[model samples]
Target: MGMTAPARWLVAVGSLLALTACAGTGGSPGGGTQRQIAVSTAVPDEPVTLTLAYTDDPPSKALIEGFTKRHPNVTIKPQMTPFNDYVKSIKLAMSSAQPPDVAQYNPGAMSSLVPAGLVLDLGPWAKAYGWNDRFPPATLETLSSDKTAKRFGTGALYAAPGGLSVLGVFYNKSLVKKVPKTLGDFETAMQQAKDAGHAPLSVGALQVGGFQIWNALLNVLGDVKQYRSWVYGEPNATIETDGARKAAETLTGWVRKGYVPAAANATADTDAQAEFAGGKSAFLITGNWAAAALEKQMGDDVGFFLMPGPTAEPPKVASGSSVSYAISSKTQHPNVAAAFLDYLSSPEAAKVQFEAGFMPVDTKTDMGGAGLPVEIKAAFTPVAQANGIVPFADYASPGMIDKLTPGVQGLISGKMATAGFLSSLQQSWNEHHGS
Candidate 1:
């Protein structure tokens, strides 16, 4: 019997990707012999055409533009979507007969796609391109399955990273000069801001923004090794733990003291960004992704601090995750898609994305000359150099967003107790993910 329509569609995408792999065998992606192998595999006459979808953000644009110039024959038609509706758009697009050749996807969404056999395996091309050694182990960790980090899960490396996306502290320059390193210092500073008649800390818990607060607290109070379970595990054991309550209590203090803005809980993302940019608040807890946005508004007037380290504990650390590139299972030109992936991680392409307002994940490529926002490179660079972990929020399913984000809004709104908040999270995780 012939395959079902969806199954045939899957086969078609896989075959297209494999068809490209079959044509050329030598050059790899990471440089040296890999570059030589890629060059020797030349199907230069073949045109690579792909459709990609992602949030219509600056870094994404810069990456796409750079990809085009490096391989003129390979063209990428980007299907940009608004941040609020991007997931929906991607879901719709992926279900179509002509899905994008590559698409940016979160871990859970990707996992779902993996089971459907919608995403192609990149192992063959990863080997052919030598991304095996070209990319960092951490990045490969995200691209790979939880089962193993050595290879792209499902045998194909469907995704590659654009940069290291980290979230932490963003603060106003005109409002505060010194950044606090420890939790105690942070408390003192928050008091100082309050005493000075300013909102000591600005938190925007609107809709899905609450995830950051939970993660930021964990960043300061939780144990590093066990944090992953807080995000991925099903038992919901984390909410009942000490770190969870401590983290909640710290945030509650900020709310009760009127250190957080009156409208903070109601405010969406732009509220915090605008407040920091305009100097309304002393500090904004956010991510490196906000670096470029702040640069345009605050320039040298902005700075960052890692989420507070333990008062008697180690230094405060920011959270980070690997940026990656993904190929469309529906793409007609797999080799061309691979070529762009190669260019993306290349020194030249890395500079383009870096200059477009982000820190490049490619260690070999120096972005110093790219002239990125000075405040970003100056502030977060040190914390990143100090090394931190990627918190649970970005790694888990969108369903997790439904759990923690609202809990955050409830916490800020005085609807939930610290213990209640943590207990809720524990219960929700177990109900969904399972113990």
Candidate 2:
């Protein structure tokens, strides 16, 4: 199909800006960067095959199927990698002579790709598809960053979200009799569960799951802008604050009360989830990405809610991230690669995303399902509508994860003080952002 006059105008404008950005950056490794390519809204009728290197499976594979079904001539070949290996190896793959047409965006990997100019700046395509209006503004912001990629939330657009996710609490209905109205009430429930010989919470302090619990608490307790500015790498930003300290104290208190597992530091996230699903724990603090598996295991016994605040009524804030994708600058077919991204905001794609246990990029799409998803959607709507979602704390710096995971483990093990935990994270942020 030919482009309409308005679409043609958008293409022209997008092409001009993209060309300027690419030229300033120059060639990538292996001399594979396309610095002079033109932007277009059309894909040719001839058969085309594109390779996508990704770690996340369900939504990645399923979304590809949904896009290719619409354009039968296009074939997407996926190169799956384990998440741990993908983050360490993707930079080399993207810098190769024959790079995948697209790859799932990883902050660690993209930190190198952005500076090397190995990933296409998707600003032009974002404009052509009116992505600003179609997707959540904050979701898009996390995918963008400065040319150096040292900071996020501004500069060239690099990716589009395939699926959205939020961090919250999941409870076993048989263990908790009612939803807690406040943070105090929530603690009371945990105490009751402990008295009944049930572990109040299952924590996976051995990995990111440990820090995620602190993050969910920080979302409700900390000032959203302060945390966001710190995560986005704004100059002079600091994570050492009263709110952050309070959040840290709360986590340590959970440890003292015997609410967190003694073996938390040795538990992997999947193991923690399995323990909860098997009805060994009353609650598990995790992302919506775990909903599908937990639903299958526990059936009608699983429930979800954002972590309650100190007061009965509090600002709806939560930490979240997207399974977003970026196109390689070496790809011969940028337009075709971008078409798949455009489809991410469509109604059909929304259904596929939700069914695969992810929140859709189009937050407005009605998730016409029941059980755990319905509960998640109900808890998620107000936060997204209020624009209260913030990026994960690990996004604060490339090395922030290194500090967070272990710092949280120390807290669970009764070795680290709250002040020390906050300072360790701030130390990593300082190293990256400059004090």
Candidate 3:
């Protein structure tokens, strides 16, 4: 069977993208001769060692352990890089002569690798392992893209998601008496929190935390298909729209209403998260990646919810990303590497992925734990089932995060108008994908 509609819808939402391979591996993704490499579902019986480069911790380390445990003859060594440095350094690492056999995907810093033919196209393995049915189509879609890496969805299978994440609201239940039922109620709660001498929202405007807030708002307020097209790099895609402008205005209004802290622009994501966990803020808007940390800090006082919409009933839309992996064209063991990728969606791996604070690749798998994790899984189920999760806004272009962080910072500081912000984003997109 072909990819499901939800998978097709998420073609543009690349995340934790494995976009590179060692150079001189195969033909370009744009229609060049594809390497006729063989694939297999089994690893060799002899001793084998594969090196892995990644940034995320819990899932990568634990998943690697789980996979290696099943096949003692295989030893997978791991190299962990910090996020910012990873973005700047991964391209070089993957392009080096002795690149890791497998590497985690990071779209912004690694798009160049795809066009350079430095990454393996896993079409054969996907076909062999029947990944189309084993993993979520949307997760697979997030990794597949054209040769240019500018547009995703209808292209070679490059990476497979090891874990999934979705963005939503994390509230301090001790402070929010009633969870908001609608967008208006959400605003009212924030206002009350502010009036009661609490910061309504703790924003990390110094980095991605700023745009993440705007992104969550747009997920609820904007037209999903239009936003998806823009992120997907479809020709003529544009962020200049009524929904985006309204989301921007909504954020600005929150700032003026004293719901957002005055020092928001100065705060970093960790600091803002700390503020919320410390009970200084009524709510924190972020992804499930923070669930483990927050639960450790606040225990039962913390709760989770998707950002509400204008009506009592809200759309299930949310921005999400994945910790995906790809094989290198230079690997001596293509079949063995493919085996590791294929293991990602297994029931055993699902347990490891869930315990690592990510939504499992097998969305249908029950996350059999309790507390905040259970709450997150409960909130995430319907959205994943509906295929409502889209990629973060920065996935729109290689340098889009540079534009997003400062653009949303301007919105929070009242230094940038909505028109200018949208125009600037479009300018970046046009530069990368053409107007």
Using lDDT as the measure, which candidate wins? 2
lDDT tens readout by residue for model 1, 118-170? 55555666655556555554455457553221113223455777776656677
After best superposition, candidate 1 residue 110: deviation in angstroms?
Answer: 2.3
lDDT of 1 at 161: 70
**lDDT of each residue in 1-435, candidate 2, tens digit only:** 144423533443223233222222223654354486556556667899999999946499999998888778899999999987998778989888899999999999988898888888888777666677777788888999998787888998999999989999999999998988789989999999999999999988898889998998898888889999999999999889878988888998998889998899999999999999999999999999899899999999999988999899854888888899999987888888987888887777888999988887767678775899888978887787677879999998899889999999988887898888889998999998888
lDDT of 3 by residue, 303-390 (tens): 9999999998855888898899988776788777877887787777888998899988877777675899888888887887777889
Candidate 2 matches the true fold with a TM-score of 0.91
> Candidate 3: what lDDT?
0.83
Ranking by lDDT: 2, 3, 1
lDDT, model 2: 0.85
Instruction: Give the Å error, residue 278, model 1.
Output: 1.9
- State every prediction's TM-score relative to the real structure: 0.80, 0.91, 0.91
- Residue pairs that clash (backbone atoms under 3 angstroms), model 3: 16-105, 17-105, 17-106, 18-105, 21-118, 21-119
TM-score, model 3 to reference: 0.91
Off by over 4 Å in 3: 1-34, 56-58
Cα miss at 186, model 3 (Å)? 0.8
